[model samples]
Target: MNLEHFDAIYQRAAERKGGELALESMLSTPLTQQELLSITDDRWLSAFSMKVFQSGMSWKVVRNKWPNFEELFFGFKIGPLLMLSDEQWEAKSIDKRIIRHHSKVMSIAANAQMIYEAGIKHGSFAQMVAQWPSDDITGLWLYLKKHGQRLGGNTGPYALRQMGVDTFILSQDVEAYLRSYKIIEGGRDTKRSLAQCNQAFSFWQQQSGRSLTHISQIIAFSCGDNRM
Candidate 1:
């Protein structure tokens, strides 16, 4: 990766109002799977509560009910969550209560239990969330089979996409870094690593024995800035 090019991209994003607003908006926004792992507090409850809440409800309704959730869930404490049983789940699952669905409400309780059990193996709830299995595999080969074992849990790729999007400043640097290179339309895919792409680029440059910059300019000229 060209660090200079990457830095320039970041500089540009830093100059954009969309980038600035994205940063501010995502600050208190609910965290993603990756964010959940990175965080060690009841923020998980807070974030997941909102997520589970919205599973069947509209964002607007959930938004309105958010304060109620915070008050009802006690900021997502694991101990308090564990204390909540199937009956308690049903009781608080009242339509007026913050959570509603029986299955989903039961899931919240079950997921908390699951998280707690996972913590036993990983030493902490954060580690359990951090260690959740992913569906994509990573490897030197480009084929899906080679890298399909998936790393970083089933949500790794999803997290990567979120990490690259500048809709939230949560991933501005990532978006900027990738945009700095000729990564093409798609962002730096999890299946394809920078190291692997760099290796390919170096091999291709040597075989072609020509600077890619010149080749690109020539192609751009032939295609025209408007059409290619």
Candidate 2:
């Protein structure tokens, strides 16, 4: 595919966002691999659960009730959550302290089980994530979608990004840029489209020496109506 140079994209984003300094200030960096390794499995579970609950609901509402989620879910500790009986989980669904969505609430245990198994296999879920190859980030997304509940599509990627994984989100603007360039086609969830996105971002990363997070943000800011 004939992709534009990262420099041109960066320039476009800078101009749109009010010059280089302003755009640079807006870009975010992912945590270092070491920092990712330092995170515990429960925090990863919590991030995943938070994203799942926020999927179709108000983000501010989820954020406001996060503490209740933490408390009721036993601080999202993988072992404790995995051991909860069906009745116990059902109780959590009706609890007044949380969102009370039964399906989303039940997803907590399923995802917790997924995390526990991953921890057993990889020392910790964080190790698996920290050691995942950045160039093949789409593979990681696939893994989460396959193994975890309510983690398909952007849900898993958003959780990963929140927890400092060096992954790009196919947000509306990013998807628009990809579609406009013919870098990807059809739905973003398909393997072919996602692989194409990975290739495009990998190329830009090589060209710019920037993280996927930065490249993704620049692409969004360069196009779309997000500019100031």
Candidate 3:
């Protein structure tokens, strides 16, 4: 129930691994609210599309093919992406320029609309994402899943973190640590499990005044893994 217990675990793991945890080295890269709020629309779309294409696929493959994706999607410009006709997107299925997952390719349009609408309402899409309470990050995750295409489960949180938002990513190692503490029970991917983990993180955040990213990184380090 104490965050110090979690810190002890991370320290032991770091000692065993013969180096500081990744989070330790990231001290200078703290993600601030102002930084997140300043992110541009293109970056938001790129981050979202990266997470979407990365789902259930090799990250290396996605990275390798990203330049082509950028070209095909017009650098993920929201306006051009929205203006792309259905036939244009359908043609991408057969085009060698990008991954041919039909549903994922189609998601670009749906997600574009999601961002566009948010921008219309909030002055900018970044405002919407940046203004979300980091203490209730799961709420933002729910909104992304409900509003954006192909952004269910881990995609939203992963994308948000990549966009420099202060949020936890429930990776396997993080989930394993949560279970080890009995904070969550059963399989790690269930709604109930996530709720339990979120509550624990919320409590710990209040106590420690740490960002969710740092806390999640500490948990993963405690497990002696950092694949996320």
- Per TM-score, the best of the predicted structures is 2
For candidate 2, the clash count comes to: 0
For model 1, residues 1-228, the per-residue Cα lDDT tens digits are 433332232234334425645523323233355664676536544554455555446868877878877777666677898887667767777847564666655655654555466568677766554453322112211221122222122122232222221111112333333354543225454434534344433443455443322222222222213121
| Alpha-carbon deviation at 195 in model 1, angstroms | 18
Query: What would the per-residue lDDT of candidate 3 be over residues 1-228, giving only the tens digit for each residue?
Result: 433454575576566556675447743234777887888888888889989999999989999999999888888899988887889889975688788899888888889999999999999998987788766678788889899998987898888888778888888887667767777787665677667777888877776577788778776766745657
**Candidate whose lDDT is highest:** 2
Higher-ranked by TM-score: 1 or 3: 3
CA lDDT, candidate 2, residue 6: 94
Candidate-wise lDDT, in order: 0.43, 0.91, 0.79
Model 2 score (lDDT): 0.91
Candidate scoring better on lDDT of 2 and 3: 2
Error of 1 at 37 (Å): 6.4
Per-model C-alpha RMSD: 11.5, 1.4, 2.5
Over 4 Å off in model 1, which ranges? Answer: 1-38, 129-228
lDDT of 3: 0.79
Q: How do all models score by TM-score?
A: 0.44, 0.97, 0.88
